[model samples]
Target: MNVVCIGSGYVGSVTGTAFAVLGHPTTVIDIDPSKIDLLNAGKSPIYEPGLDQLVRKYIGKTLFATTSYQPVHEADVVFIGVGTPSKQDGTADLTYIKKAAELIGAYLHPHRFTVVVNKSTVPVGTADLVTAIIEEASGLKAGEHFSVVSNPEFLREGYALEDVFFPDRIVVGSNHERAKNIMRELYHRLVERVSYEEISKDFAFPYNPLTPKAVYFETDVKSAEMIKYASNAFLAVKISYINEVARLCETLGANVLDVARGMGLDSRIGGKFLQVSSGWSGSCFPKDTAEFLQTSRKYGTELSIVKAAIESNRKMHEFVVEKIRRRLKILNGKKIGILGLTFKPNTDDARQTQASVIIQMLLDLGANIRVHDPKGMEMFKAVHPHLHVQYCASAEDVAHQADGIVLLTHWNEYLQLDWKQMLSIMKTPYLLDTRNFLPKKLLIGLGYQYEGLGIGTEQEIDGGIMNQFSVLSV
Candidate 1:
């Protein structure tokens, strides 16, 4: 299958690259010539594990990238994998999607039956909107010449390749049977793969260990769009719920880790997004939740729990700042080191990251800030150039001469940091584990004042390291 993906952003690049890896002739198109040049030079525009290597391997083989839509007429399938960024009013900004649709329409073959897939996360009826736009621009009827399919992507940032290759499920939502069949044929290799035991006997499916094959779910177009938003909204709620539990644990002197462990063991509540933190802020969760709420409002419906979850997440970041304010008593002229800048670890995305929000709050309180991240420094600096922050080379560099340290993103590298060395460099060895990722007893034993989210108890439990938090319900 010849696949042409429009808008070579995160989704476009990953999706196009994956299609090319599957032996399809894939061309990724973007408006930015620089992004296309980077892709053509065997480099990925965004930071994703295994993306650069894949791009390098397939650049001249099966993968191509361009800034023009001239190849659309030759494509069997054109995927609009553009970014549908959220507007300030909390609605999805569909400018990019609309433009891609118009361009696809302009270059679409007049007689060929091309399947246009909407890989971008969009609101309901967007496929219909794209269909209408394409029809208007191409002067060809949608059902006769081309059809639109709502195939929402569920790729995670850090593990996009893994998610694409071994997805839990592949959803294709369309009314046109021909279009659906085309999509099925396009993804046949992934869905209908040979037995893993025959290929790599020792290899394991790390994501879905028990599942042998990824499920294929076919649904209506509108429902497919809702699935993406609902999925992220539910995860956001779980995160916010855990943070609320952490707050209760703080008040009741309980351990949230134990609580989560006990709850996760239940077959009904198998854990995935239950990690307690300073709220959920990322490209997907925050924007999707906001859009979901906005859609509900437009439909004259209310999602009270979702509203509360959003509020709780906002307050959670403020809670981290409050902990520092309470410990130091004076924010002005106080030097603090912040660990982690990205919203999540293992990816260099800094859009709507919690670290930025917390840093801004700290700055507002007149605290001197120094930040460090393994991969997010360049992106963080690029995103937040207006703020005056000391971008350090390493975690210890950020900690040096600081009065306090706050662990924001739960990056694995932070786990291996020399805590005692960090203590030696800091003016005051006060640590706030906002993600509750560190060992409480180990830090306390090192003569450093350690505070973890929802950890109020000072003593160890069951002869093990002390851990604490448990439940928030609507």
Candidate 2:
């Protein structure tokens, strides 16, 4: 199949490249010339693990990129993977998706029946909206020359390529049987790829070939859109739920990691997204949850659980800030080192990162912030150019002359630091593991005061019942 993915951002580039690897003649379109140049030169503009290798292998073979929609009519399957960024009112701005639909419709070959897939994470009823736009632009009747399908993407940021070939479920939302049939055929190879032991070993983590293959859910357009929002919002709620537990654990002297592990052992509750982090922040969860709540309100209802999750998520950063303030008497003139900047590790996406919010709060309180990240610094600078921050070369550079160090993102490089040596250079040996991602015993043994979220603070003892322990003695 000749496939074209519009908007070569993270989703578009990864989806288009994966199709090209699946033996389809794929073309990725973007408005940015720099992204196109990078794609043509066998390089990915965004930082994703295993993406560069695939791009390099297929750049001139079956994968191509351009800034033009002139050749889009040649594609049998067109995926609209553009971004629906969040607006000020927390609703998704669909300007890009609308423009892409019109562009595809205007240039699309009227005689050929093409399946236009809504690969972007759009609000419900977007398929109908896209169908209307396409019909208007093409001057053709719907279901005659083209078909629109709401096949939302479920690929995570760091694991996008792997998720593409081995998804948990493949959803195709279409009212038209013809569009559904074409999508099934297009995804047939992926379904087959998951079952083969050799291919599964190469792709699946831990080489689990016995893993169940991805299931397909054929639904109407609206439900498919809801599925995407509901999945992300539920995961966000899970993360916030554990963070709330972690907060109680901080007072009652219970280790959240153990608590999470015990809860996850039950088959009813899986062990994903239960980590006691500062909070959940990224491209998807915040935007999707907001949009989900907005959609509910539009119909004269509200998602109370999702609303609490958002509130809890926002308060998490404030909680961390208060923890730091309590440890150090005043924030004025305090030099703090931040360990990571990106929302999560292994990608350059700093959108809605908790670190930025925390750092901004610290800056407002007159604290000098020095930061270090293995891969996210340049992208962070580009994203938050107005925010003044000192970017360091390495972990030790961040630690130099700092009053305290806060682990924001759990990057692997931050995990392997020589904390004993790094602490010696700092003005004070205070280590705050906001994600609880570091070793607590090792840091304390190094003669440094260590703190972690929901890992039982110094004030709490070993029981749900509390005993007298000083928070300052750690």
Candidate 3:
């Protein structure tokens, strides 16, 4: 199959490269000249482990990048991956999708039956809209000349190539039998593999241990689109639920880690998104939840739980700031260090990250902030250039002369930081583990006053740590 992927960000860059590796001649289309040049030069414009390696191996052989949509006429499958960023009122801004669809329609061959796959996460009725637009632009019937598919992506950042090569499930949503068959043939390598035993023997199937084979689910277009939104929104709600539980655990003097582990041990409750953190903020969750809520309202329904999750997520950031305020009674002129900036580790994406909100709160309180991340600092600075933060070169630099330190994203290297040296350098040895990701016993032993969220009576459980609030009694 000659695959043409629209857009060159995370989705197109990784997926297209994987397709070329899977023996499909893939061409990535991007409007940005720099992105196209990077792809052609055997470098991925976005950060995904091993993606550039794959691109380099197949660059001019079976993989290509270009700004022109002229190759659409020859493509058997064309995937639309344009951005659907959230609008002000929580509705998806479909401006990019519209333009991509228009260009695809204009360049579509009259005789070529292109399987137009909606690779971007979108609303339920998006496939129909795309079909209508293509029909009007190309002067051809949809099923006769082309077909639209709702094939939403489920790739996680930091582990994109692994997920692509060894997917647990592949979904194709379209009414046309021909289009579904074409998609099946396109993904036959993974879906119709030799045996379930072959895949299980390697990974132990940690992603989906219960599933045997990588199931190629065939469903209606609307259902396929809903699956992506519902799955992401459910995970977001699950994260918020645990954070709520963690808050309650703090009041009741219970260890959240133990409670979460007990809850996860249940076969029904399965622990994927149960970790307590500053809150869920990433490229997908915040945007998708808002759009899901907006779509529900547009069709005369309401998702009250999602609304609460959004509000709770905002409060989670405030909750972290309040804990900092309680520790340092006055935040003015305090030098605080932040360990990580990306939503999670191993990806350079800084979109809608929790660090932005937490840092803004510290800045508002007149605190001087220093931050460091192994891969996310460049992206964080690009998105939040207005934020007055010192971009430290290393974790030790962030800790230098700092009054307190907060570990937000649990990068692996943070585990090996010289805590004793950090404590020695810091003006005040106060440390808060926002994700509960660091070693509390070691930090406490190292003479730094260690704090973690929802540990057994560590915070706000019995009137503050060691009667520190007793001084506030008036």
Report the lDDT tens digits of candidate 1 across residue range 349-381.
987789888999999999999999999899889
Question: Model-by-model lDDT, in order?
Answer: 0.86, 0.86, 0.85
Clashing residue pairs, candidate 1? Answer: 255-468, 255-469, 256-468, 256-469
Can you list the residue pairs that collide in candidate 2?
Answer: none
**Which sections of candidate 3 miss by over 4 Å?**
193-211, 457-474
lDDT of 3 at 126: 92
Give the least accurate 10-residue stretch of model 2, judged by summed lDDT: 464-473
| lDDT tens per residue, model 2, 136-191 | 99997789888899888998888887788778999999988888888998888777
lDDT of 1 at 222: 92
Q: Is candidate 2 or candidate 3 better by TM-score?
A: 2
RMSD of 2: 4.4
Deviation of model 1 at 460, angstroms: 3.8
TM-score of each: 0.94, 0.94, 0.93
Q: How many collisions per candidate?
A: 4, 0, 0
Off by over 4 Å in 2: 194-208, 458-474
Poorest lDDT segment (10 consecutive residues) of candidate 3? 465-474
Judge candidate 3 at residue 433 and give its lDDT. Answer: 87
Ordered from best to worst lDDT, the candidate numbers read 1, 2, 3
